[model samples]
Target: MLFVKTVTSFMAVQCVRSRVCHRKFWGWLNAVFNKVDYDRIKDVGPDRAASEWLLRCGASVRYKGFDKWQKDYNHLPTGPLEKFKIERIDATESCIMFKGFDYLDYLEHVEEIKFQRCIYIQDECLERLCRIQNLQKSLQWLEIISCGNVTDRGIISLHLLKNLRYLFLSDLPGIEEKEKTLQILIRALPNCEIKVDL
Candidate 1:
């Protein structure tokens, strides 16, 4: 009787493992048992918020606006995150705005940044971007399409990006001296391919 009971129990366990226990089942169990209590995470300010955003997104994240990002993350800062390289970002037509370069201090490994149709990006933002450490070595491609406030001065600062190979600055009405701007950029980045629509 004891031998029969043990055999039945073992068979039942094997049956459950083969039929009921799958990847989704295990994942659900883990979430239910090891859920993170975000309420306990302390706010470490805006700089940490940027790091947290990268941590959550890994290499890619898309949001409608900054408010959505804040709301989705529960407004808590995450930090001392693992050194993960973010190679690309696309924030086209999003309400995301940059306050300063401080927000991107941790993303030193980013290679491409796009803000196409982001009208809020201005000369000050471009100036701040030029100040990012190691940007000249790491950043290769940039696109700021339809950013009307970015003038020749703003685009000029990008000449500091030594590794920059491709630049797209289309639909910028403020760049009245388009020919001069293109010439200056061409002289600065001889190997770069630049596309502009005055």
Candidate 2:
């Protein structure tokens, strides 16, 4: 299959409490650019420019907060995202609702992915995340926080990631089975370091 690749930009604004000035610049970008390669998206109430850079290298993006950027997202160049990185996405709040998990199939070069406050992610997405081993050969770090969806099944699924080095998990809600889950995740990265907060 031919992947139609293009490069696009996405910026977020007014998301964090501390970065008001940064939010202004992105907000301006959102206001001035109409139907540009980049779009202004808001997920988890507001958007952050720090995270939006992930899609700057791609054309089409299956981004969280698609609703906030729906109008802009529709305007993205109709082609494959050339290359992209994903970081610090609220999977439960954004991915599950937006079906952002499907986008992982197109992330051929994503080296790092951090999931935070994503409650919707479950075994199904975790299954897909495990499959990322085939795509992210250069991937080094995977961090997840406050993600109640990643259960033992999801933790066990990570065994295939041979290149993964740093694994960080914190504040996961359904972590009553912490020991078993940690053991499974540790087994996945026999050659790497594993850090977990129980």
Candidate 3:
């Protein structure tokens, strides 16, 4: 009877240790995964093992300038990435190349998007963003700084975001007539605070 109790206690202690180890492993993985950007994605993109690791722990991953290096790599394994619970995406100082918006479709939980300094963001990218049903409903804040490629046509697509509250478009050279565009946006979204630096 004593041996039985001792064995049970030992098993309980092992279980506790295993839980602690699992937590520690996940914590470490999260820390490493959060640092993944376009530069590191190159190395992780080709390696199946690294991609798998990212897929498992990349729910909180924030890829700034993802479009800068995205063109260099072939399509990474996205099967497991579909399950990632990405909430915020920042692609500042990058390019939103052809069909680049398609990659964000899987992120159903995305709320905030920052494309500040993205020189390649154009009408096509905005069109793609408009098509995202989840983003249309859930997205609240959007920042597009110094994106000269985005014209009035591109800005028109953003009117579909019924829930958007904050819109920032600073130093956009394409917007030749800023006041007219600002007026149009204000009339369309009376509740939203739109900021533009022409």
The clash number for model 3 is: 0
- Candidate with the larger lDDT of 1 and 2: 1
TM-score of 3: 0.58
Clashing pairs in 3: none
RMSD in order of candidates:
16.9, 17.6, 16.7
What Cα-based lDDT does every candidate model obtain?
0.63, 0.52, 0.62
Q: Give the per-residue lDDT of model 1 (tens digit) for 2-57.
A: 99999999999998887766866754543332232233223443334443443333
Q: Stretches of candidate 1 above 4 Å error?
A: 1-48, 51-80
Clashing pairs in 2: 4-80, 8-58, 9-38, 92-118, 92-119, 92-120
Clashes of each: 0, 6, 0
CA shift of 85, model 1, Å? 2.7
Q: 54-91, model 2: which lDDT tens digit per residue? A: 23312222343233221133254333333223322333
TM-score of each: 0.61, 0.53, 0.58
lDDT of the structure predicted as candidate 2: 0.52
Q: Candidate 3 on 46-163: residue-level lDDT in tens?
A: 2232233334332123332242222122444255433434456566654344333444543456567777776557878887887888788778888887777888888877888878
Q: Identify the runs in model 2 with alpha carbons over 4 angstroms from their true place.
A: 1-93, 96-98
